[model samples]
Target chain A: MDDPEYRAGIIDLLGALAVGELTAFQRLAADAELAPTRADQAALAGMAVAEFHHFEQIRDRLTELGVALDDAMTPFHEPYVAFHANTAPSNWLEGLVKAYVGDQIATDFYREIAATVDDDTRALVNDVLAEAGHADFVVDRVRAAIDEDPSVAGRLALWGRRLVGEALAQAQRVAADRDALTAIIVGAPGRPGMDLAELGQVLSRLTENHAQRMAKLGLSS
Target chain B: MDDPEYRAGIIDLLGALAVGELTAFQRLAADAELAPTRADQAALAGMAVAEFHHFEQIRDRLTELGVALDDAMTPFHEPYVAFHANTAPSNWLEGLVKAYVGDQIATDFYREIAATVDDDTRALVNDVLAEAGHADFVVDRVRAAIDEDPSVAGRLALWGRRLVGEALAQAQRVAADRDALTAIIVGAPGRPGMDLAELGQVLSRLTENHAQRMAKLGLSS
Candidate 1:
């Protein structure tokens, strides 16, 4: 937070997160409509509402920093928007899997990146990530769904892999596009950045966690 | 609150409100996508999130009453779904107009209905309806849009009318189908309900308020 580059990187990260949450709120609300039952709809809507609150917190932080929210968020909007557009769920199960897997990946990325930021920002990020109750709800729904129809697991697992691929591709694009933001993560002067080896470890951990999540949902990732 | 008839009516009212908020949450999120700018999108999403919270509160209240939420909300779902389907906005301005006009009518209806229920239920319904800041945001957007193109106001005014028409029709259908709920508003044992003259007065008040809202938007109702 001291260095200008570090600050810009932090803003970029938060902006991306805010926009991601905003869109997630929209997509999840839309997805809730696809649920066959009112209970399922309410569960997904609850998750979407949680995401909306997170977005508000991050956006308020940006405003407190005297940044124009749109300007701060503009650079990162396209990539996240494209990610959602490219991975629009085809059915209710796909929507649930997307919500579950997509949120975990984002939370994992946030946690990894939080380590390089200042204490305050790290705390904020951690608070957002710690709201994990919704994940279990999604997991239970997905597991129950798969239990009812085992054949669908294969398609959903494929959907899960596609989500990961699209997410990583978008992440790379954002990193390449925003040098300052990338510097915050990969290393810049006066900023604690991840080294090549550490980066590899992070990726391995993310992939392993994703695999475990898919397996937990009775899917073969 | 103690009478079974009163309790059943309260449950039905809360159930309808819950489903209304759920569908409103969905529709507003979809409407947010039509926003021309990030700020507008965020504003609408904020509105959607508020609706989600209200849904949760009403759902919880129903659960407290030993009513299964899905069963309570299911009957009201179809009418709301049909209403939204019939009045889906064609653009950003129309969306804004819809949000503004639709919310006011719903709030007005809630206030009228709140008068008949017990104090506790009245307070809960009033709390849900009292969230008013989003209206100002929406009003500003609608007025600004009208300023940009006067002709657009004509289109939006018509859109607003269609929304009210569709809303009233569906509400009538719901009232006809759910006699217990309707009885609470029209008349119930020991429940001070609206007489014919009072009902006419309520209708006039609703229409007058809607017209004033339209005029505030620089539109002829």
Candidate 2:
């Protein structure tokens, strides 16, 4: 794990994630207009603010690890950008659900990955992930909105599926190409030996969480 | 000055301003997307968040003062809404300037009004105005952007003037109509007014601040 190759890979993955936070903040801030009320706008804007705060911590951690931000983030630039480009949510509720479910899965994935790292990275991960409070707030609002309007149930559930799917696909692509960092997740040198048992465990947990979340909205996932 | 009518008018004016913050946060949050860069978007988002926080305290104070939020804020709402309808910033830099300079003027006006009140109302206004840190941050970004792009100079400066003019017109309307709040500012009923004379003082201070601000940006009023 201390090897140069492993460290390099770790830096790249984190940089991509950091930049992703930056972009999410920008996108959500823009999407806040779709919110029907000032209260709703505040909720989304809170999430957007949290994203940049997350980015700040992650960027600081990258610097602490002696990673050249530009270089560490370079390998990830295109794919991460494309993912957001293709999946930009068009309306208020869609954007809220996107922030909610998308961030839930990402947080789950990050939690899993953090366990695989050494002390420094683990602490940094913990710090950056403190941003989930706003994510939770958004989820409640989205669920409440769906509750107020039953027809929104089907569409948002479907939207949640697409968000999780796109995230999974992009995550897979990152895994395939960034083996150095991917190795850290499975605590193995290669994908062949890497343990996805941990991921399976998380997927089951996330599915349960998602199901409960849907039920909270009086909807079937 | 201690009359019920005067107190009601003061509450009316503040209520309108409070709702204005609420609406501005919503619009600005959505307008954040107009920013061309990640940093710019983050700055706008931060400003939007602060706007929400600003009004929340004022709302809470109104509640403490035995004023129903809806009733207290009812009078100034439509006029302020019309002001926003009449003038909305068209681009990113213009938006930032609108938030920074425009909000600063509003805050200054609020501070002046607060001075005319007794202890609690004054304390509430002072605290509410303190949350403008993010607006200051956004203004710096707008100024830096203008400095970097001389070609943007003329357009932004012109935009800045129009923003101020629209804002000033709204101020005049608020002052002229809210005679009760004006009584609070003028001190005792028959006394010479604080706001009318102080309006000049406030404008002069704003002019000085703007001069320094423009000088820093290498621009002229």
TM-score on alpha carbons, each prediction: 0.96, 0.78
Task: Please give the CA lDDT of all the candidate structures.
Answer: 0.88, 0.70
Candidate that scores best on lDDT? 1
Q: How accurate is candidate 1 locally (lDDT)?
A: 0.88
Q: Which pairs clash (backbone N, Cα, C closer than 3 Å) in model 2?
A: none
TM-score of model 1 (CA atoms): 0.96
Question: What DockQ results do all the predictions give, each relative to the true complex?
Answer: 0.81, 0.25
lDDT of 2 by residue, A1-221 (tens): 45777677678668767867766766776666577664565567667767767877777777788776666666665666677777788888888777776666677678667777678778778778764666566667776777688798898888777777777788888888887777676655443333567668877887788777656545567
Fnat of all models, as shown: 0.82, 0.24
Pairs that collide, model 1: none
Q: What is the per-residue lDDT of model 1 for residues A43-137, given as tens digits with 9 covering 90 to 100?
A: 99888888888888898899999888898888888898899999999899999999999988888988998888888999888887776488787
Which segments of candidate 1 are over 4 A away from where they belong?
Answer: A189-192, B1-3, B188-192
